[model samples]
Target: MPVIDFVTDEENLTMTVTAEFAAPVERVWAAYSDPRQLERFWGPPGWPATFTTWEHTPGGKAQYTMSGPRGEKSTGTWEFLAIDAPHRFEVLDAFANEDGTPMEGFPSMRMTFEFTPAGDSTRMSSTTYFDSLEALEQTVAMGAIEGTKMAMAQIDAVLQDLRDYAQGKGTRVELLDDTHVRITRLIDGPRDLVWRAHHDPDLVRQWMLGPDGWEMTECIAATEVGQSYRNSWAPVGDTPGEPFGFEGEVLLFDAPRRAVTTERMQGMPVETLNDLNLYEEDGATLVTVLIEYPDKETRDMILATGMADGMEASYARLESAVLTPER
Candidate 1:
């Protein structure tokens, strides 16, 4: 893959960047072409931009303000140089004052993006040509590299979210063998009640714990497939404890029914898939769980760690909550 790369010339005072994404060319193009979607994941993480105008065509103009933390803001404009759907786009980028005036002492540059097909992913190369090496060096010194890294990371996250939203209906986890420890439990409750047990953070904390004094520190339910949530668990007994633990993402979120899933880490690792199915039968709900790990070692470890016990307990808590009288 033609991953993101930044090249600077000391003698000429110029810089260029190239990066790729694991998506189709068309899919990648939609992100850049759609102003609303672009704003959703644009700029660095936590610093989103507001698009004033976007004319996505050759010779058209795009204006936006990039806002930083503490209300710091910089407006900019891009004059489209070329446009080829799902393939190529070129534009001029410049720094400007918040009032839309071009900033003095800031050099404008040309940005060219080329999208190429690489199997199931799109190799996107974005190159920015500065006027001189001084400009490139000065920009780099101003934290351009770190900012770009954050921006690309945001893009990756947004793309993954988009993919998850598109494939929200089906389950991502597949069952491999019967020895993988699959279980199905039927609860005598309405679908809404069962759904509430999984969707509510407080309810989730009640059931998802080990036999000892483990407690959930943080929990968030996205209520959508491919959306992510984090649950932190800590030991509270008289024994020693792990510093921080417990993390997972929503792989499948079928409201009133089931969820499929995986664990999210800071960086990439071997993929693990989990499938949860919910169905209503005779005024009650039945939940089926299927977990798939990369290898036997992981599967064995999960089983030995009392995962099923915790799950059963969590469901029991859910049952109690459903059966409890309304106050």
Candidate 2:
């Protein structure tokens, strides 16, 4: 975890969070300045944020919505007060409605975020100034301290370069929270080819086989939002496993960049949201899949079935069987 200290002072009407990262100050600052990167960790676990409007200059404003696990959403806005490059920035943060109007009876906080060098690493201190003691206590009672800590804990990954973070890591699973997990794999192919391999039936059939003894018996790729996709696999002769399949509807489809789908096993009622993102640098693509389960029990049950190992095998096959020939 990145957060080192969280302090709340009622007399001063302040809440401060201190965190340290293994990255430089500039890299850490970039994560906050970029809307795409900031959205990845701005909210607590299981409640990912989407920034709709971001103007990084002083006197500009940003609007965002944090979507909860069960279709709930909370909107917020930030008015940039100051920007000092890779050193510090200040903003007025407040709760807002869907149309960016500030909510009534809620006090806004003047937040100052400072980044400094801590030896080879970077140290960040965020102090929130409330208008009154009641406002400070109210925010703390609403879980501000713990929520900020959880949110900052996710920043380390964002500060890392894709190649440095996922290369040679195989398919690794990170438990983000009770019901959320992130999986990453570095593929030796361009972003377009990697995305095509996921959506093209012919390419998927060539590499999606989980193991040597298995074969993809059926594949129906979904190419657009609201479309449904299905895939089934079965073991070859003398193989040990039984036939199984999964089906899902595509919620988001941004070709060659990102995709989001609702996945569930065939004949099962439970569902999980799978958010897939692809980033490429120098002919290599990093694949990130963030999955949100219905509950902790369901999350553990699914991961216990050796999912990461199977994904690693399939990714290796994708590189050799699908990408190598095209290179």
Candidate 3:
């Protein structure tokens, strides 16, 4: 087994990183040359990435979007300089605007990837060259090297796991926009358990509030799509407060699947979206909740308000309710 290593030369504005994989040269080559296979394990951990466009020929390009952490969308074009099938490939990479137009302030860099067969395994090396030392310094400050290494490690792990399973990984969650709160885990429990925890009036009273004495005064769930639901909450601390609330229509509801969609319409009145998807995995059910916002600004605001932390707490409470044995 070969270890991963990084060599940087700030004066030359260049960095070279190398790693060895236990897999055959063919396997590692396919992972890089094929876009479809690349998407399965291309991103860093905790973020989902989608490859929008990819062409392997010289002067061809590739674009992708990565979300999670902070919902940043980036695009880049690749000009293939050399292509030696299953051996080596080189290209020029640059940042582009969302509309696919080249942007200022970003350095166009040359990236070359070489794959050499070392016995039954493969030795992989990547060399990145910048236009100038100033550009390199700026990229270093942006943590480009560290971020790239992290992403590559994730790809390696994902590839090894897929080989072990003899199958690919499952679909991932993509960040729609920038938001303050990160939804860490989407768990699935029994339909009755989920419904009782989210819809039952009594269950709502306990875990939805915080330490400052908050209460859910009203929670209404309508079965129909166009029908609406409203939740009104108020603080009950030493300082009396007015109600803070949200109201939205039921976009979807399927009891068997235990899925629901709610749109927020009051208090903050911001358009907050929530989706719940439930299905069976193994012997137990899994539930995935997706939340989207219009942009990154509001997402940051929600994060600053401790909403993400509050959400994790709420999920923990739900877990407790299901895991506790029934009398």
Candidate 4:
């Protein structure tokens, strides 16, 4: 097991767990920074985690659900309070309802995670501070300590399998639920540039074209909440396919980190929520988009249209035509 010390102090109303990993600090940090790596081991052995939302910066929030063996499920949320990259971070951890609101009767805790270099390895100390002794006792009674140990035990493998989790995999998609899908692509550029590429009309027109023989005819990007944005595409010359377009109104906009929009095909009533998040680690940015469709049929129809392959083509073009040239 990676956990070497598990201590619960009722006097201080705190529980601290210390674990050692056979990897460098950067590698260990990446395991937690990337939601894909985190979901693999965040839950105990039987309950696997699925992070629906991940915003790693300070003042951001992350939401995840853990599915149990017997169809049971638990939801949780983390509100980031502080972040010191590759070293320490703090979050307000709490039980959450299905809609992501804090669950009543469950106490929230201030959890701090610190990573330090130890010889050829890294030492991670996680400390959870409760508001009251009753709160600490309540959480401990709910298998928090044992569950945490089991969860940390699974991280060693994630830290070791670096290639499987990182870039060179191209754009990938995950079915989060019947109506929700997640798409991820790791871009070889900084987060700021990648965010700008999605918003700047000139940069967007250069890479957002999905495939060869296609051209972006209109590029109107929304810069603030409630503003509408439209993008249209047309085949070049005699290339097959009709002109298509999408229009959306921005619901939330956090530059260089996240954006949420309501998207729909032109003149179509069916709409989907598109959530875009960007995270930078080790000079590269990971782009994650969570799309919520109207229903299963719509989700399947979109996937059947080779959405992932088209996204891969656009991301490839982005690297070649925009990022590479800038570098």
User: Which predicted model would earn the best TM-score?
Assistant: 2
Model 4: lDDT equals 0.87
Tens digits of per-residue lDDT for model 4, 1-327: 799999999899899999999999999999899999898789865466889999999999999998653346799999999999999999999999989999999999999999999999999999999999999989899998888877786685478643345579888787755877768888889999999999999999999999789999999989988899999999999999999999989877778877878899998899998878776766788787878888999999999998898899999999899998888
- For 27-109, candidate 1 gives per-residue lDDT tens digits of 88888898876875566533457789898889998889875423457788889999988799999998887666779999898
> What does candidate 3's lDDT look like per residue over 154-242, in tens digits?
45433454323221222233343353122334433555655556666667665566434567788776666678878788776664667
* Residue 219, model 3, lDDT: 74
Q: Write the per-residue lDDT of candidate 2 for residues 130-196, one digit (tens) a residue.
A: 9999999899888887788778877766788767777787998888779889888999899999999
What clash count does candidate 4 reach? 0
Pairs clashing within candidate 4? none
Once superposed on the true structure, which residue ranges of model 2 sit more than 4 Å away at CA? 43-55, 64-75, 97-99, 132-147
- Score candidate 4 by TM-score against the native: 0.59
Model 3 residue pairs with clashes: 179-299, 180-299, 187-287, 188-286, 188-287
Query: TM-score for each prediction?
Result: 0.52, 0.86, 0.53, 0.59
Give the runs in model 3 whose Cα sits over 4 Å from its true position. Answer: 1-3, 161-327
Q: Which candidate, 2 or 3, would have the higher lDDT against the true structure?
A: 2
The whole-model lDDT of each prediction reads 0.66, 0.89, 0.63, 0.87
- 1 or 2, greater by lDDT: 2
What is candidate 2's CA lDDT for residue 239? 96
The ten-residue window of minimal lDDT in model 4 covers 157-166
